[model samples]
Target: MTTRIDTRFAELAHKGRAALVTFLMAGDPDPATSLDIVKAMPAAGADVIELGMPFTDPMADGPAIQAAGLRALGAGMTLKKTLDLVRAFRAGDDTTPIVLMGYFNPIYVYGVDRFLVDAKAAGVDGLIVVDLPPEEDAELCLPALAAGVDFVRLATPTTDDKRLPAVLKNTAGFVYYVSITGITGTATPDFGRVAAAVARIKRHTRLPVAVGFGVRTAEHAAAVAQGADGVVVGSALIDVLKATLGADGQASAGTVPAVARLVGELAAGVRSARRAAE
Candidate 1:
């Protein structure tokens, strides 16, 4: 049952480098432009794509991501539209793993069973439902894995040894290690601590640990890559997209290229990290 996520991580390991995982809000500004941005990600060097399912109240998301979700929702982004985006992206590129990242409310309302079917049909490889916990596996996690979609779980800095096993219990795809304790994009992750945290989580599960939350630049990605199997960049990319938006708060001509360029730099950082470490 090797999923696309598993395969991608294994491939990165063979190359002796970390993966660059990019997060983008689905239908931000509008569906068409958002799709174009996603379509350009792999070519820009994103090893994995996390398509955020825009929910009204994204409790776990920081301000940047919260605003991005609101913009996507305002532009008519819905659970179905997000899946359609994934479907459209899959039509052209089949190898880049697409993970639906967001809170669980949208999926719950969409109907768990139905969402699973549609997501799988759309070629979604994984999911990151931030609100769902290990105790609630029956709600979505178990069913998602049953339907062949990897259910990725988040392990925070607060997840001590006593709680690590429970967090990793049903987690698939990879363990997302939140580098900071608070909301995302507020502070820089202490790379030394990140390396140690990744090592701690690795002892509990064989799943690849991807460090996220505080990763904002190529240097941050590179430093975290010294220990993490993958670097997940979300808020930073949203900030890039936001900065390039037009005066009318619409997608300008510069939006896609700007994001792609940043991703390319981050990818270079991740790929060269191992060399730097040696």
Candidate 2:
């Protein structure tokens, strides 16, 4: 079945531009402000939204994203509340694909069957459980696919040709190519290497490839967008939001606009990729 993610990618392809996928922690600072930030994303040029499912331990996340998760959890954010946030966002916007990104422990605790049901009903289109592997596909990936929710897989620089097929075997929506070797937002990827990596992965699967990790500025996004079908920005946005927070670590008046503005810049950068390639 064609999901919202697939439709969005197809739409962007038709428009001859890469997609700008933005990430934000659910209920960061506060649910109200978080919702407002998310609501403003699409208008700010976000093509797809990856709402973080805040967990106590986010092993794949960098310090910025880790802090964002903490703030969300400290604000009483839960898997259920995260879904509620998506549900709320869906009430107004239905076309922007919402992907719940995080570990699988919460889903295991929340009951995969029930979580899938509620997530689909909540208008969530995809998932990016960083901890889950292809060997454990039965655990969540397969079920997610059966539930019609695209389970996006990650491919790092280390994923060689022998492993690329396995990684893309059941991956849906798109393949997230981690441009760097470490955690999110820690290092900048070599633009030349990233393009080659995207090309190699495309040779393995027909699915769209989105490059993330260390993509911070519009220039960085534009560079990656030259080869990637989508440019994923997370840590930089978290850092932006964190910087805008008040002394008490609560959302300030600048938080939402700050993130929106950055997303707009990144989107413009992504839009310029094809022209730059020409």
Candidate 3:
């Protein structure tokens, strides 16, 4: 059950480190810049990239991500085009892992088995389907595993003690712990509470636990990394991308490099925190 993600990211945990998994909508301003953003992440220090598969109704996302998804949709970005971005990103670098993060409707529309085959072909390592809870994994999980993909799970603070083990059962890649009890982007995570939650989840599963939702700054990344196997940044990064896009509704040339530089800095913060822990 070796996955493209595990091949690249699992080793980082052995070094007392966690991956910096950043999510961004491809083609928010345009496709080429979005692809540049993807390639620039590793240069900045990202161990794995979560290329957000934008959908019209992204219930889990906050304002920033929802707006970003809308912008991407307006740019004519499709699920096919999104996976193609992953394939294009892989052409230049083979090490940094890429995962598709999205809801299930678009994939279901695209046909699950066909989507899995395309995703594998595009060099995707894993998936983070926002709506697919533990009980209904058979919809895509089994086919994903058969395609050599990791069916990642997201455990919230509400996914409590009684239901934790079942949530951990079919998870093969890693467990994404939403740091707060809310949607992506609007969170002010309780680091202590998040740390405790991570510990509790660890008691049930050996899979890496990545914390996400409201992580914005380097200091925030450092703090979250204390109990997380990875720190995921989404809205904050999208905000930066929104900034990079100019006032007149056009993508600026600096958006990709600037976004990469910021995420790289955050990744460094997480790495430095891990070093201090050791």
Candidate 4:
């Protein structure tokens, strides 16, 4: 079954350019503003949208993303509300793939079966549960696949050849290659090493590989886009949104525009990669 994710990547492939996958918390400053920011992403050139499912303890997230999650939770951004956000986004734009990126606790608490049903109904195309490894496939990964939602797996620098197969065994939609070793947005990745890593992973699976972590600028996105099938920008966007917030941590007039502006710049960078190659 070809999902929205598969279709989007295929479309980008045909266009000879990498995808610009944008990420943001579901209700960072406030739900209304958050929705506005998301709705503006596609027009800003985001080929794929990874909406964060804010959790109490996002172990994989960096400071910017962690703070974004806190602000979301503070504004009562529950798991259900996050799904509702997706549902609302789908009302206007159904073609843009929406991937719920976060940990697994909330899903477990909400009951995986029920969550998958609701997520599908809400038009969620994929999921990136950082905590669930390939070892625990039955817990959520396999079930998610069966439920028709792509479970995107992450591959870090530490994942050796022996472990790559297991990681890619049931992974669907795409494989997220963590360019840095630590949490999101902490360090810059060596573009050379990232290219080699993407090449190495491609040797193992036909799935598109998206490189993320520490991609802060258009130049950084361009560099990764040269080798990666997609370039993901999360922390940088969160940082921009945070900066646009008021002193009370609420969305200011500049919030949505700020994020939209950055996404546009990053998308241009990603698009430039193919032209440079040509």
| Per-residue accuracy of model 4 over 1-278 as CA lDDT, tens digit each | 88999999988898889999999999988899999999999999999999999999999889999999999999999999999999999999989999999999999999999999999999999999999999989999998999999999999999999999999999999999999899998999999999999999999999999999999999999999998999999999999999988889988889999999999999999999993322
TM-scores for candidates 1 onward, in order:
0.97, 0.98, 0.96, 0.98
**Which residues of candidate 3, in runs, are more than 4 Å off?**
275-278
Query: On lDDT, who's better, 2 or 3?
Result: 2
In model 2, where do residues sit more than 4 Å from their true spots?
Answer: 275-278
Cα-based lDDT for every prediction? 0.92, 0.93, 0.86, 0.94
Span of 10 residues, lowest total lDDT, candidate 3:
269-278
For candidate 1, lDDT tens digit of each residue in 148-200?
A: 99999999988999999999998999999999888877788888998999999
Clashes of 4: 0
Off by over 4 Å in 1: 275-278
lDDT of 2 by residue, 1-278 (tens): 99999999988887778899999999997888999999999999999999999998999888998889999889898999999999999999989999999999999999999999999999999999999989899999999999999999999999999998999999999999999999988999899999999999999998999999999999999999888899999999998999998899988889899999999999989988873321
User: Which candidate's lDDT is highest?
Assistant: 4
Query: Over all chains combined, what TM-score does candidate 4 have?
Result: 0.98
lDDT of 2 at 27: 90
Model 1 residue 129 distance off true place after TM-score fit, in angstroms: 0.6
Local lDDT at 216 for model 1: 88
Worst 10 residues of 4 by lDDT: 269-278
Model 4 Cα displacement at 91 (Å)?
Answer: 0.5
List of clashing residue pairs for candidate 4: none
